[model samples]
Target: MNLFKLFQDIEAVDGDATERLGYYSRRSLLRLGSKALAVSAPTVMASVLNEAYAQSSSVQDVLNYALTLEYLEDDYYQKGNAAANLIPAADKAIFTQIGKHETAHVALLRGALGSAAVAKPAFKYPAATFTDYQTFLLLAQAFEDTGVRAYKGQAGNLLGMDVLTTALQIHSVEARHASEVRRLRGLRGWVSATDEAPAPVYAGEAVTSQAGVDLVALTGKSADRVREAFDEPLDRAAVLAIAQPYL
Candidate 1:
């Protein structure tokens, strides 16, 4: 929750981060960061965040975009958790906890958007998505991975605002969900460049450099190791392409 370091990291990834963070200059962003750092009165912090997001039509669109994904995940987990024999008893707790997080995320994003929130759409899945454990695991892996990348892709759109902090927190949870799902599927906790089974979900993940720094060269690590160390963001168009089947 280091606000200053968070802003610095965002700028490192996307140099124009502050410019899009409520149209603020570096000075204004630092001032906001200082306020967020102080952890003063709750109302004062709330007012600052409201000012950052309440007036932006663009932020509303981002929230709605996020809501769609949450609704999809929430519905998926609800049906899975309710199914009599879908999830194995031993892993029921894991999925149940995951489902609750999704539901809470849906509520949080929906409340923020209020009237502007997008209505939940009917979710569709492959045959035996829940009835078969292996199928269920596969689909969960894909959904969770897509969710993580999708959130990271939206980070630049929500830079200096406190909402960005909120998004990052959710992003962290999504990543844990992805890692757990991947491990259940017998893969490592991280995505591999060769894991393109679900087509473009793992596509474009083979990069070796980030922020103009060659990670492999800098760290003296193998290319695959370097690739596994950093996550690649998926643009909205790419994420929607992957999400189309579920909506």
Candidate 2:
């Protein structure tokens, strides 16, 4: 349906990129006889919009992206939970809970998308990926942390109060998952400026300024604490690079 061309046309609209994209995404969805539902709701909506309107919208594009990541995470946790002697005895329940949460997220996103939902991609985890409990925890931390930032990065691109609110709700859950995973790994729940193994995920997160004020200078907080106080957003390219390994 020439979706890329539709996005290009959306980019040409006057105003900020976020506003333009949001407007076009909403307008296009409305043309399909649906209200802006949820950021994760896109598959069936995309199909209807594509057929009836002859074009796919940017909102559907965002939802498809979200669904892909959710599928990756859901599968990761499900595998980890089922792996033989992988998760430690004490931590098994925690992994179970986390796995359930991820499963629920996948279901919710899929339900929202209806028929337009993208099929889950085949994932390729290395042979030694989750063999060690510590290794599994580390990867879990990365996935959860990346998920939190990914949602934040796309907040502006979502349209409608309902859709934006739903995305934010999911974003908070991802942040909690990140914190829990960090705790399980015997690390601080919050990230510091020094932690930068995966550069794309933490890049620019060390900044101490907010609303033109130097937070460290004004509040006398340490740079690390300032960095922890706010989570930075990762652009789509950055997110994709971080997620590419498992896809």
Candidate 3:
């Protein structure tokens, strides 16, 4: 599909009742709170999105697919933090901060989409292959790294400047989370040594299409490819399939 059409499709599926499920929007928050927080401006200016135009049949599967990942990350950290022994005392504080940040992100995205935000499907991630704390860190490193990239990958498909900007904001934070996790894992830096270090990039920030660049290049992958690695944008059904096993 062409880019705009793709975005519209994602937006359409994202608007359905199944996606909204149990959420209630206080119009007060929808107006005043969202503006104070700068949530509504981008989508409104770019897409002219309104509740009337949004329908369940019109929701975009890709958007919901992306939302599912955010839910997964938010829930993972929430649950992960509760496992007292899972995180080191020194790191627990920061881990909770990241968890809270992810929580806010999910909430922010949901609010921006209004009722179009998809439901959090019951999910269970595949059993982590790690056997030790360090190993788990490695997995954590991978997950955060993947998150940083995934957000970037999806940004282009978003038409509303407001939605794009908000997504970009979250994307940068995810990068920070990735860097911190990498450091904890004893990795030299967030980016591979051959790649630039400490620089953050996002999918919504720019548009580029490259495949498997991270795997092929020593410079680590560009921020955008991290999103692409997960492959095509997923619809609701596809997202639930992957996430269901995790829940």
On TM-score, the candidate that comes out on top is 1
Backbone clash count for every predicted candidate, in the order shown: 0, 5, 27
Ten contiguous residues minimizing lDDT sum, candidate 3: 198-207
lDDT of 1 by residue, 1-247 (tens): 6767644544433344446554543444466676565564454544544544444657777778888998988999999999888999989999999999999999998877667678999989888988999988888888888888999999898777777888899988999998998888788889876655687788788889999999888999899898888888898999899999888
Q: Candidates ranked by lDDT, best first?
A: 1, 2, 3
TM-score of each: 0.78, 0.77, 0.55
lDDT score at residue 240, model 3, on the 0-100 scale: 43
| Superposed model 1: Cα runs more than 4 Å off | 1-55
lDDT accuracy of residue 207 in candidate 1: 87
lDDT for each residue of candidate 2 in 133-166, tens digit (9 for 90 to 100): 8778878888888998888888887644345676
Ranking by TM-score: 1, 2, 3
Model 3's TM-score against the true structure = 0.55
Evaluation by TM-score, superior candidate among 2 and 3: 2
lDDT of each: 0.80, 0.75, 0.56
